[model samples]
Target: MVDLRLERVCEEASKLFISKGYARTQINYIANAAGISVGSIYTLFTSKKAIFDFVLKCIIDGNYMGNNMALPIKESDFASLDGEILNVCKELSENFEKHILDGDDSYDFKQMISDVFDIISRYGVAFLIFQSNGSDSGVLYAYYVQFRKLFCENVEKYVYNFMEKGEIRRCEFPEHHARLILETLSWWGMHVKYDAFETNTGISQDVSKNVAMDALLHAYTI
Candidate 1:
């Protein structure tokens, strides 16, 4: 029972941090939002910083309650690498499509970029924390490194699938192409929330993706 309250406190604390920023968020704020006592929070977390650290770690580690941040997984039924990659891309594409199309009224392409940026800005707190604390905690640093490496692997798989399907122009350096796409997305993630740029929201996502596909096809598809 205490553990559950602690968990709720952590969740409320995270939302408050994202909504209000960390330094401004107080123990009373968390206690009120979580419907728990300030002393109880102290029992589970040594300090507000500790609670923030846990919240940041949880958000970046793919446990953020409001964000569907799961990594693309290959189905057990798909035995082949190509099949797995296709399934993963399809899933990713569907997610992006829904956001780009069926999201809240303002969720156009520009808003999509904004959303990506929002996710990055929120997650960056944890990443920054990890970077600062890396030397002190070998295990935590190693875990973050592992996730970063997996992110790269997933990018490569997606790029390879595009090449295989003739959706993109083939690059002599496929890895470089993969890196470019990943970096582009990361850039959007990092800067889009606070920096709203003039994106092509006038175009539909399908048309936008088609344009990207056409550009790649013209550049690499033989």
Candidate 2:
């Protein structure tokens, strides 16, 4: 079972880090947002940076519970973590969009849409943090740009190839449609839950995937 305080801390920290940027988000803010005391926050994290590091690890590791995790990650652990973060993001960015390009016999538009949704749903929060806090996190921001460019290029490739094959509908500009599709997936997968101005649709992640994919398939499928 996930520790209640740890889960709350990670959730609130991720939200605050994305919305408020790393420098502005303090332990107290995370604690307040998490409905825990400032002292309680320290018990869970040695410092704000530790919390940030822990959040990044959880996002990448998908192990929010800290099951088998060392509690209260130390500053010593932060050493070399930035490189680790970049490496993980780099590998995923390099490989994820390739999931769409499995030759003609295996290509499936619905499956392609699922792959897009899965990647964004799984990794988009980290991307949002990288985007929103570019000033404080130049390294992550630069990496975020590369990650986005790589994914966009792959999407464009898939669109152009399938269009040439007469599978999915062809657009005047496959690049634009690639971005459009990405925006749709981003909104449903990540932004809807985080955008402060967005009205609550109470849509679960599974429902979001289905709705977004079905809509995209309707618009793009031949």
Candidate 3:
């Protein structure tokens, strides 16, 4: 089991990294936020980079329990890293599956869209970190790209399933529709809340999700 103090360190470090950017965030800041000593932090993580990597992995896999953060994986452990990436993909696929529509009606489509938005909202901070170009973490970015592809593929499958069910109109470009849906959700559920610029429209999550659902349903419904 992971130590509670270690978990607190990772959580505080992640928040600081997100707020201050990776380069500007310091180990001391994390120590202060986590109420731990700098030496204690080093006992858990070899360096700042290691802590960042651990936080990134935890965020991507939604492992808030800090199970992954407890034991730091070695940098040379490519196989272990691949396994972690696969776990992230599996977690994302399960979330997408939960939102797949099962009925042939606008209400079903709307609920699916809302659920998708909620999923994105739950992972909003992680997505923001993934999109940050200021960070030099190429490995994290690559894993994020893989996760995005997996998510879009599952969304495409849902689109095809809905089309076959006669819930949505047949389209020649299901991939395009899936991309549009993902982009819409990402912007409304994530960017609007976390982007550096003034992108907030003062719209509630329900209003934004409802508007997006209405637009999508109108465009694709029979």
Candidate 4:
């Protein structure tokens, strides 16, 4: 029952935080949005920050591992390497377009990264604290962490494989390539589309993607 209430509150608060920036979203606003009283929220969360943190973690867990992460295709599993590579790229491109590039980020990328780390830590501690206690919290946390780890590891492997195959340029580091791909896409899509950056220069999404793709190919091929 507590978990259900937490999920509901977090979902509603997530909406509010995204629609209205975090600074402007007050506790009363969340309570109203959730169709609950201000006091009711306090029962579940000590403060509005607590609510925001939980909601932010949920968003990161959903976006990073749940959807955007890509897995590897084994050589034996695929009839042809070329076909498998293209398939992976297509899937990854679609996910990038939909989740990370679709809209203005509710929080900055750095904050999202930090929140993801926090959630991982919480999951780890939950296990240690509840081992042999058979608490449902421990079970749920462990399962969620494992599920997320699978996606994260798969995505990292996909990035490394693509680099190794010369599909993408050799990055200074493999992880750097993966992180930059995401960060560049998010910043380019949002700021370029909105002209929100200090610089007046803006690029279309197609051009932006092509530039990055071409630069990568050029760097890797020679």
Candidate 5:
């Protein structure tokens, strides 16, 4: 059906954009990848920019194919999409602070760990696309760098707070251990799905998160 091909166009275009970057991806290349004519692309998209905008909006909405709305997908404000990602980055840090209630004896580290993995799993596809397409000095890459630093800072805060309170097991080079825990969560939560070298890529997100959280808990607890 025309609608299915339309979806294919968007899906293939997204992959090309992820692999080749937006400016470098050609109309002919996208058409060929989608098994469609350049004219067919033009029938719906007024310009290559339109196609890119649609794909970007879909990615921001969730992942590959969006809600599959009717044809000639409207353009999205890049500022809005940019802000959405930036806000997510900010919220991750803020949420960590919210969980770190001073002297709150009932705070649950396992629940916090679960929530972070859920966020990563929910946005994994979009995150992966931006990471691959983002140039080293581009805004997208900068967003990723900001997120990494914030995540590390929060993890450090948690480790130090809990260690001082005699909660988590104290260890030599605690900062390094915090980094290790972050990497472990990152791998299983997000990167595992896309890791070409990972043999267990087929595991469900539930299984991945449980295993990752268990590893961190067992490794860090007394």
Candidate 6:
């Protein structure tokens, strides 16, 4: 079991690290934010790097491992498109499209945006921390790249399914489209939420989602 105080310290440190970056954030800042003494922080973590490592561990343990983003597509699944895997994919595609599309002409753009935002918001702080520390060499960076690649691949598969169903127009570069959508959602749902220097636009999540989805749908849909 995790100690309550230690958990509190990690939570506070995560926020500070997100907002201020690792180099800029200090133990004193985290200690104050956690409502604990500097000594208490030291007792729990030998150094700031230790606290960051713990926070990264917590994020991994929180199931942000990207395994749940999409079903694994086996080589055999592609060879036998009529296999059970394709059947499962079709079912998932139907369920996913149900919430986003109405016929082939209309879409619930706002709802799709909301769903994406909600999913990304769960990892907003952790993503911000990763972005801030992206230049560093470590296991965290490896996990970050791995998660991003997995998500992009998942989106690519979804886009390909939509194309096959004639629900969306075929793109010259489907993978690029997938990356764009994912990066856009990451920016709005995570980066903008915790930016330290940018002046807040005071834009609510709904409005941001509407605007973003509108532009993306315009580009991707017929």
Best by TM-score: 2
User: CA lDDT of each candidate?
Assistant: 0.52, 0.80, 0.70, 0.46, 0.71, 0.63
Model 5, span 97-129: residue lDDT tens: 676756555665676567768777766656666
Those runs of model 2 whose alpha carbons end farther than 4 Å from true positions after fitting are: 69-71, 97-104
Give candidate 1's TM-score: 0.41
RMSD of each: 13.1, 2.1, 5.7, 16.7, 3.9, 11.2
In terms of lDDT, model 5 sits at 0.71
The regions of model 3 sitting more than 4 angstroms off are 1-21, 24-86, 95-108, 133-135, 200-202
Cα lDDT, model 2, residue 27:
83
Segments of candidate 4 deviating more than 4 angstroms: 57-222
Clashing pairs in 6: none
Each prediction's TM-score against the native?
0.41, 0.90, 0.60, 0.32, 0.74, 0.57
Model 4 scores a TM of 0.32
- Scored against the true structure, residue 95 in model 4 reaches a CA lDDT of 46
Tell me how candidate 1 scores on lDDT. Answer: 0.52
Residues 78-152 of candidate 2: C-alpha lDDT, one tens digit per residue = 677678788987787667655554454476667766888888888877887888888866677787788788888
Higher-lDDT candidate of 1 and 6 = 6
Q: After superposition, which runs of candidate 1 have C-alpha atoms over 4 Å from their true positions?
A: 1-45, 57-124, 191-222
Which residue pairs show backbone clashes in model 3?
A: none
Candidate 5: regions farther than 4 A off = 1-56, 59-70, 74-79, 101-103
TM-score of candidate 2 against the unseen true structure:
0.90
The global Cα lDDT (0 to 1) of model 2 is 0.80
